[model samples]
Target: MANASSAATLSICSSSSSSFFSHIPTRVPSQFSFNHQKPKCRLLTIRAAVYTAPSPTPMPAASSSGIVLVDKSDSDKVNRLKSVYLEKIVPILKEEFGYNNIHEVPGIEKIVVNCGMGDAEQNSKGLEATIKDLSLITGQRPVKTRAKKSIASFKLREGTTVGIAVTLRGNVMYSFLDRLINLGFPRTRDFQGVNPNSFDGHGNYSIGMRDQSVFPEIRYEALGKTRGMDVCITTSANTDNEAQRLLALLGMPFKEGAGPTVLLRRKRKKAHHFDSKIKGKK
Candidate 1:
């Protein structure tokens, strides 16, 4: 009876031990694995983030392009006034209409330079001489131009401010432009092309000429002497935007696709820009 009881107790303990071992996790020497029976709960948190980049800058328009801008110095209105148009208008007319040709557009007000001398009493004798000199060159009297002095400008310096402009048709503007460029600008050693944004919104430009002879680069030998000019071209009074439109129509190289509205910059200025002419020590 004692042996039977002992045997029964041993069997019961062995079975319980086996069941506990089965419920506990077991590891193999070589590797281990998970059952993964439960559904994944982390999928709801995943999301895609949207991102974007900026656009590129466009180039300048063409029509408003011209020469260097000179600082206006203190001088009388007449001395301050220099019209590049006076120098080239005839040529433009000739180029478009063929020699001595003038294009007549009745609606647009013709640009005329004014000396605002008020009355003869205000017009000094010196003014008379200047007017006579002007008369000899331009057949028309020095009528007042519709443009006013730049308000921010301190004062109109005599022989300082020069007016530059372009008044030619697509075809004529082209022909005269060839002549002016060929005669005016030298082949700058690394010349690319002229800036399209030289003009204001009103399609006008006034830049300084180094000298009359800086142009006339027809032959290498002819540079020493040539009749050069300083001038400006102005448009019929309108908004700056419309002026840009007119210049684009005339073939000014606006950096942007169609025409010049604002001025264009060739190379961008960098944060660490340096001038070749100056010592970069500082």
Candidate 2:
């Protein structure tokens, strides 16, 4: 009985040891295996995306052919002063001047408006104001005139802006002249006729205004300073006589006892005196 009991106890101990060994795995399963060559390392190259801006679209080039088209309807319409010149002034000039061809009759070419700023070096604002006032008066932009050379006596420097000027031609010239003759001159205080002797030897006439206030365009209250202006009327005439006649016919008021006849007489006297002097010298 003791030997059978010992055998039973030995069997039971071996069975319990085998069950414990079964519970704890001796070899890892295929799912958890570390022998699969580490998935070949794969060097995961994470390519970062870079942003780029698109190029601007090119603009269409302008037409190289410099052809300019004019409107016929607009060209047909004549300016007020232009029509007057064609209809009335042309015939009058032809008859009076004994002009065989109508083309020979002299006409106004252009008008130049100038404003000199004597104190431009000292006062820049005055220069600016003069430019503004001139533009207002002329209905065109005035170009700033600069000193060509430095003048110590006048305190002027080279390239210093000392004046402003505007040149008017075509319909604009006629319009401005008409306005100046009819409106501007009449508006002056203690108004008198323009100087008849203001003609240059080269058939150009000049008129000086004391201030720009005479023009309807300028506002007296808005003006910073009283500015003077010079108006030079250039003509296609051959002589001062022709130019004077042309201007007088176009409604330039001359002072009493100072007309083209007087100018002609003065010129004749000067020529006669010059001739006499030459004879005496001989």
lDDT of each: 0.41, 0.78
- Best-performing candidate as measured by lDDT: 2
Off by over 4 Å in 2: 1-78, 260-282
lDDT string for model 1 (1-282, tens) is 999999999999999999989988676545555566887676567678968667762321223343212223312223211222333232443353343424431112333223333233344554454444333333334433223544446444343323222234433333334344444445333344445456565546533333443333233453332222334546653454445443333333344444444556799776556564355664
Residue 217 accuracy (lDDT) in model 2: 91
Error of 1 at 148 (Å): 18
The lowest-lDDT stretch of 10 consecutive residues in candidate 1 is 74-83
For residue 181, what is the lDDT in candidate 1?
Answer: 48
TM-score of 1: 0.27
Clashes of 2: 0
Question: Candidate 2's residue-wise lDDT over 122-200, tens digit each?
Answer: 8887777777777777779899889999999978889988788999999889888877987888998888898878877
TM-score to true structure, per model: 0.27, 0.63
- Error (Å) of candidate 1 at residue 142 is 13
